[model samples]
Target: MNFREFAAKNVHRNVKAYFAYFLSSSISAALLFSFTMIILHPNLGAIDLPEYLIKALNITTVIAYLFLFFFVFYSVSVFLKSRYKEFGILYIIGASKKQIQRMISIENMIISSVSALLGIIAGLVFSKILLAVSGKLLGFNALEFYLPVKAMLITFIAFVIIGIVISIFCSFIIKEDMVLKLLKGTKKPKTEPKTSTILAITCVVLLTTGYYLSVTSSTKTLAGRIIPVTLMVIVATYLLFSQLTIFIIKLLKRNRTLYMKKTSVLWISNLLYRIKDNTRMFFLITITSTVALASIGSVYAYWRDKEAQIDRSFPQAFFFSDIYDNSSMVDEKVNFIEGSLKNEGIKYTKVNDEMKFIIPKGEKDQVVIIKEDTYKKLSSILYLNAANLSENETILAMPLTKHGRKNVVLENIELEVASKLDKGIIPAFYEEVYVVKDEAYEKIKGVKVYFNTINVKDYKNTLNISNNYYNNFPQDNVNKYYNNLLKSGILRATKVAYGVILFSAIFIGLIFFVTTGSFLYNKCYMDIIEDKKKYNQLNKIGLTFKEIKKILNIEIGVLFLFPYIIAVIHYIFAISALKYAFELNIAVPSLQVIFIVLIAQIIYFIIIRKNYLLEIKKSLL
Candidate 1:
């Protein structure tokens, strides 16, 4: 028989179990495809966003791909382990390991091709949907046909390569083992995780140091050093999950008083057994949960911290009105507010200033004569600066700040000059410690200060005054004054980033929810099925399905909540990441992201509980 026929018949043997992997992988593939296209596509994404943001998205896509790849390989390995006896039987029937390997390869190729095709197609369609959604939020028109052939090709190539490599490696390991060993491997008891007080203390020290460095600004080179520490923490965390989690569960189980008093003991023990096979899945899930929460939390943090930056940018209040005809004058409202402040006995500091004049010192201060020629019109012996000297010649200079700090001479200014400052302003005036004399300022004609900033009582009152004036205007005028100009692009980009993160959270959460619950139920349910006789014996001793299911529901909920706790810890670490990169300060304790995570856990547990209850009731009947 052909591989298709062989797969068609035998694939259903582990239907509920492998189905979880199939669905989870398909969803992951779809997400990965869409994200890869959006990030790497030269023409896609926002033009106005910071270039760093696009680079960050590319990094995120790579991280997601690595996680998905691990889970896919893990799932395949689990399948091989579960069906080792089946492979042994095939060997007994005179099937060569190489022949069996070929069949397995062909079967995997067919399944993967179908799934990737379906997934990429769905991903392409979803890309258009998200594109339109993102475009509308960004205030832009979507391209008529957004899918690119090159993108699909890359995704297909990636999926196929991963499948082939995993399949080949799997078969190699199986070929090394004899049928006897293969069959016996299935019955071997699981080895519990090894943990010690020393290891636990070490983990705590590593995590605490990492988290402390993350939250505080005391650490320098946060940019350069974070990578090494982050990698270290990730390793330590995995080691903890592998060692400490099982230790905790075993300890809880050994406490007979605590264990026998409730059903948590049974669920914890089952979770410990599942952990061996599902370790990678749990780790990936924890990372994704962290990423999902950080994505939304960052944007919310942006808005909360908005007011703080505005204060730094402008420290004034009620300094003006919309008296555009008199743009430079102090408004009557400003005077009135000052009077009110005086009446209240409030000593508000007021500094009115406008002094911006340019002067010429020498050839260095003369911008006009020598440096004016265009590159295309340049002739021989053209010099960048007025002073022509050896290449080794050097000079020093300083720059001025608005705060009036003495200019520190970082470098000397350079310019071409016709002669001494017979005329007024010059280029060197732009450079601080610019040796331009006061006489040059007088010579410079018609150079006027742009605006006088009168520092006032409160910045918000000034903003409020501006808003009230604008609100009084008609609709079209408001767009002309503000919305269509200053803020339109900034809001669009921020909104898209927030939306993408939130959408991914919900999508990935569902994928995890369904996969974890079904995978667990599929494994646990099989044991429950075989134990039908045992459960029947229990029923004979007077335990009802309701009592059993109630216990099961509580047990499953606790079990589902287990990895989620670690996921949340990861989320907490992710929060401080933005502090090192972008200033993210959200007032909310990221409680919303945590809440969404909790909701996902509930959904998964509910699904597991429902399946277990249905089976228990049916078995009782």
Candidate 2:
């Protein structure tokens, strides 16, 4: 056969070994191609999208390109490593080093060319769906799909160049001097896997410390500690797989009763070497899966809880406030809003209150002062408890702040804190508010501000009314008003932005997860030669196929499952930090993400196990 024909036949003969690598490369190409198509779409610019949306898409596209490069490089290296023995055989049969490199180049080019073509076709098939989803998330009209010649050309060229470059780099990974080691492959191992006591203990300490900081740190401190905590956890997880796991397995082996059990001896003996060989792979998978889960869970939680956040920040449907001197203008705006609401047949309740700004004796910040009667009327509308303040006592109203009774000297008047309200009755524009007795309010000297807060029966449906008021009397330094409709519009925009984030995160996360599984799969098949020889020997000694299956199940299960379990543990601590940082209860969404990933992992494990068993079985026959 000619040289190029030999290379092509080699790829075709070892297609099983190349399957995962091919699949990963194709999917990566498709992901990049789809993203490019969206970015280059003619309709993307016509839609009224957020300014950062296109920037975000561009950034994500760049990230995807980088990811594709790394993934291709890594997969190629692993695939070549698994074929070192084959290369050694070819070398003994008179294949020159340069000839081998040429063969590898040809094989890689074939795979890359075919993968790129298939990926482009897949991208074309899914482009419409991608655009539809993007349109929905961006809150724009459906983006029309065009024949993206530029995208197709770019993705195809980029993928092919990356593949060729990676293949050339990978060809040197098998050295001429390492022919003996390559020939031996997995058969040369004689030393027992060793664990470092100090590193194992350090792993425990680091993980505990990281988890502690992640769960205990407050929002104020979380930002500063995030990097340190992440580094600790990552280092600890590496040690966990490389040192701690081996240490535990060694300890388990000492228990004669458990170790002597049927198939336990078989699987455990195999597991020690397998785990040692796969330590780095397991660590990589665990880290990748943890990042994916945390990203998708956090963004999903944020999108789900957005409306509740809006409710907390905006308690009133419509709020208008201005200096008492601007009562003429304020009156005109309020009349216009109320008239519009009435004409639209919207039922509402209006509460009027006057706030006086006073600088405390020892504080430069102004505190808003309102009468107890007005506080009660507004509280009644919000269904909050009305506070009863004595002549010299006042209630502090602040959201998410807890404090005990304290005294404040407002303009020479000493006021005792009677109580506190965790919920804000007034708009957030007023930082701190004090509710005092009417007689006491009259005694305080400060600038007087009059404001009205209205609650509509269906405040969510008042967007048009809110927009009308905003259009007529736009907010400025002089005209201070909180239109629920305007705020809702802003909230909608925020949701759209977050939705885009969630959308991108979901796709990226899925890609990471799929690639992670492919990595494990390729690693497993890389050992198939050794596993078949080992199991075939046992089969000669009266080990039934059933027993062999059981042993294989245990081995593959541990290899595939433990990393994900560790990843979930890491994700739990991660989202715990998120919960504390955002002060949002994201437990449900986080759990849902975990459950979904767990299911996907289980399914993947089942499929890999079946395929692995079949390979081993074929060797035995």
Best by lDDT: 2
Stretches of candidate 1 off by over 4 Å are 1-3, 36-63, 124-128, 136-157, 190-195, 205-213, 217-236, 239-256, 262-281, 303-544, 573-583, 613-621
Clashing pairs in 2: none
Model 2, runs deviating above 4 Å: 39-41, 140-146, 319-343, 349-374, 391-422, 427-454, 465-485
- lDDT, candidate 1, 80-133, per-residue tens: 766677788888888787877876676566556666777788888778776665
lDDT of 1 at 318: 25
Q: Which lDDT values do the candidates have, in the order given?
A: 0.53, 0.81
Best by the TM-score measure: 2
Distance (Å) between predicted and true CA of 292, model 1? 4.4
Q: Clash number for every model?
A: 8, 0
* Candidate 2 displacement at residue 477 in angstroms: 9.8
